[model samples]
Target: MKKVLLLGANGQLGSDIKKVFKEDIELICLTRKNFDIAQDEISKLNKYSNIDYIVNTTSYHKTDECEDFPDKSFKVNSSFVYQLAKYSNENDITLFHISTDYVFDGMANEPYKEEDTPNPLNIYGLSKYSGEIAIQNYTKKFFIFRVSSLFGESGASGKGGNFVETMINLAKKDVPLSIISNQYMSPTHTLDIAKAIHYFIKNEIQDFGIFHCCNTGNCSWYEFTAKIFELTEINYPISKTTYEEYKTKALRPKYSVLCNSKINKYYKMPHWEIALKEYTNIKHRKI
Candidate 1:
């Protein structure tokens, strides 16, 4: 079996990948305790001797919190990723890194293509974009999968609880919800992402480049939340709000919906809403 080293294994995406690929690969997941990417590169290289692939799911995901902790965000998102890319290049290991859709400025009316130039508005996007640059400069065999609005069984906590869960909880408490209607994205399922990565690995695609990996369709945050309430049979009163209403330190893009044309042509996954229905039905015993 091929050996794979997964950084940030406890994270939502990492955990889902772990659950899916544990039996097929010799999986080694490292958290902050086992291996700190912020440490020196020499030490990081020494810890993992012979790994075939390194999937880095670790990220400073708190977009709002990043304003207060820019240094820490850069360390994990940029500097550490640079070191990992260097190591992967030197060791001839395929490096797969997860990136957010925040890298784009969200000014485009259409979905962002892989060739689009990134003009990140905030520290988090800058750091992630920096990481992407590092990989491009350092490694020959690297895959940068950019996704957005991820919600999964494992990512509930990271994403401020799953969209469905939060809506259900709020509904049960009889609280009215206000979601942003202006901000748009194709909400991705982590399970589908894992399967897509696995598909690429199985086919041994050596063409290392950036790929957009998200569900088929797109919707605004308000529309997405409404869908969650609809699917869960929760009649929570949801009010439409603009991005301006939900002010945060980070400047989110007005529209960060990624185009699936490339991934669909190469490695297609299911539609966003369909995947959500499947996940909710499986987990909540309803479709």
Candidate 2:
């Protein structure tokens, strides 16, 4: 079995990846406390000379927090990525990096393809986009998977709470909630993403490039929350609002629906909606 090193193993996607790949591969999951990327992490990782693949899911994901900590964000998101890319290239090990859909400005009327030019509007997006560029320029053997609006069981309690959990919490208080309706993108389940990554690794399809990995269908944040309420039997008052009205410190993409045609053509996975329903059913014990 090939040895795979996973960074940010406590995060949503990293946890999902651990669940899926633990039995299949020799896995090394690293937490921030164990291995911080800000310090001499690349040098430390180089000590693991036998690792076959390095999957980095660690990111500074606080969209608003990035505004105040742009330097920290770049240090983790961009500079660390460069270090990993350089190390991976020298070591001849495959690198799998997770990126965000926020790299786009959301000005396009259609879903973003792998070949589209990125125009980020916020520091978070810019940092992620910088990482993407670093990977492209610094390494040739890397897989960059860009996804959007991720939600899963592991995400429910960490950092900023997930949308599903937040809605569930609000339901307990019987309070009305307002969600932005104008923003649109595929809300990908972390489990499905993990499965896709596993498929890529197992197949050994090493065509290194960027791929859009998200659910097949597109929906606004409001619609996604509404579905969550409906599925969980939560009788909370949820209202649809515009992004303009719910002004955030960070500017979110109005539309960032990623077309999964590339991934579909290369690797076969279940449809995103089907995967989402499966996630909800498994988590809540009902759909």
Candidate 3:
């Protein structure tokens, strides 16, 4: 069996990857606390040099929090990525790095593609884009996947859980939700990302470069929330708001819907609406 080292095992995406790769591959899963990349814990790979792939799912992704700690943001998102890229290059290991769609300035009329030039509007986006550049410069065998608005079974520990669950919890209070309508995105599911990774590793892709691995289609935050309630049969009031009205420290991409044509060449990407409905169904079964 081919061996793979997965970092950030406890995060939403990493956790789902653990589920997807079980019994199919030789996987070594490590959480951030046990395997801190910022401290250079990656040097321990010398003991496991036989590892074939390294998938990094760790990031300092609290959008507003990134503005408060620019140093930490760059350290986790860019500097550590550069270190990993250098290591992957030297050791001849395939590196799969998870990236964000925030790299765009949210000004495009069309969905962002792999070839488009990045113009980040916030510190978070800048740091992530910097990481992408570092990986391209430092390693030849690397895959950078740009995903947007991720929600999954495992709640993001630092961000008070994933957005969908957070919104559901807020709706329990029977209060009106002021959601941003101007800002749109392809609200992707972490499960789809895990399956995409599985496809990439199984097919042994040779074209190692940036790929947009988000769900198809797009919707505003308000519409996404409405769909969540509609699927779950929950009655909640949702008010339309704009980026300006919903003030935040970090400037988010007003339109972050990613085009999946590049990755669709390798694996089929399901629509966001279908994925969202499936997620709600799974959540309901558990409850």
Candidate 4:
């Protein structure tokens, strides 16, 4: 049985990954308390020398926080990733790192391809891009998945829960909510990503490089919010607004829809609407 070490196991994606891999592989999950991948030296990981793979889901991805502390952002996203890559190379462990779609400038009319040039618009994007470069430079046995707009049942504690939860809570207040319509992206389910990871591992993937992994289809935040309301039958006052009207500390790509043609070679991705429907169903059962 191949042993896999997963970082940030308590996170939205990491939580789901655990569920997906529990019965299939020898999985070891590490939260920040277990080991701080960012602050801890690479030598600390030597104890797990038997690990066959290291899936890094840890990231400093808060847009505002990244803007506030560029050093921390790079430390967690770039420097730490570089260390992992270097260690993976020396240890003969396969590395799987999660990245973001923010690396693009979001000016493209169509979805971004694997070969697309990254033009980060904010500190968060720049830091993630730096990690991507570091991984490419330091390791050959690595899989970099650039995904966008993740929502999961676990709800990222650092981000104050997932976007769907935030929207539901806001709707409960019965106040007028102005959501951005200018920025578009392919919102994905964390569970789907987990399944994709399982598929890759089961298939013993040969192609190793950056792959755009997101649910098919795209929509603006406004459309996404509207769909959420439609699914839940929640009567909430939602107004569509532009990015200019939505004041934010960090700049986001106006369009960050990533093409899944590359990953499709291994697994087919469901459309965003389908995943959203599934999420709502699971959410309702919990309530």
**Residue-level lDDT for 83 in candidate 3:** 87
RMSD values for the candidates in order, in angstroms, are: 1.6, 1.4, 1.3, 1.2
Where model 1 places Cα greater than 4 Å from the true spot, the runs are 39-42, 45-47, 156-160
TM per candidate: 0.95, 0.96, 0.97, 0.97
Question: What does candidate 1's lDDT look like per residue over 1-287, in tens digits?
Answer: 77788888877787788878867778888877777676645355566768889989888878988879999999989999998888899989999999989999989999999999999999999999999999999999999999988877765435666666777788899887888988889899888888888777767788789999999889988888888878888776888889878988889998999998887877887988898897788668876
Give every collision pair in model 4: none
* Model 3 steric clash pairs: none
Q: What number of clashing residue pairs does each candidate have, in the order they appear?
A: 0, 0, 0, 0
* Candidate 3: regions farther than 4 A off: none
Please write out the lDDT profile of model 4 over residues 1-287, one tens digit for every residue.
77999999999999999999988799998899979976788788899978889999999989888999999999999999998999999888889999999999989999999999999999999999999999999998999999999999899859888888899998897766899988899999998998998888878897999999899999999999999988888877788889878888898888999999899878998999999998888876532
Evaluated at residue 126, the lDDT of candidate 4 is 98
The alpha-carbon root-mean-square deviation between model 4 and the true structure, to one decimal in Å, is: 1.2
Q: What order do you get sorting by TM-score, best first?
A: 4, 3, 2, 1
Between candidates 1 and 2, name the one with more favorable lDDT.
2
In model 1, state the lDDT of residue 186.
Answer: 87
The candidate with the higher TM-score, 2 or 4, is: 4
Instruction: Give the Å error, residue 251, model 3.
Output: 0.9
* Superposed model 4: Cα runs more than 4 Å off: none
Q: Give the TM-score of candidate 1.
A: 0.95
The better-scoring model by TM-score among 1 and 4 is 4
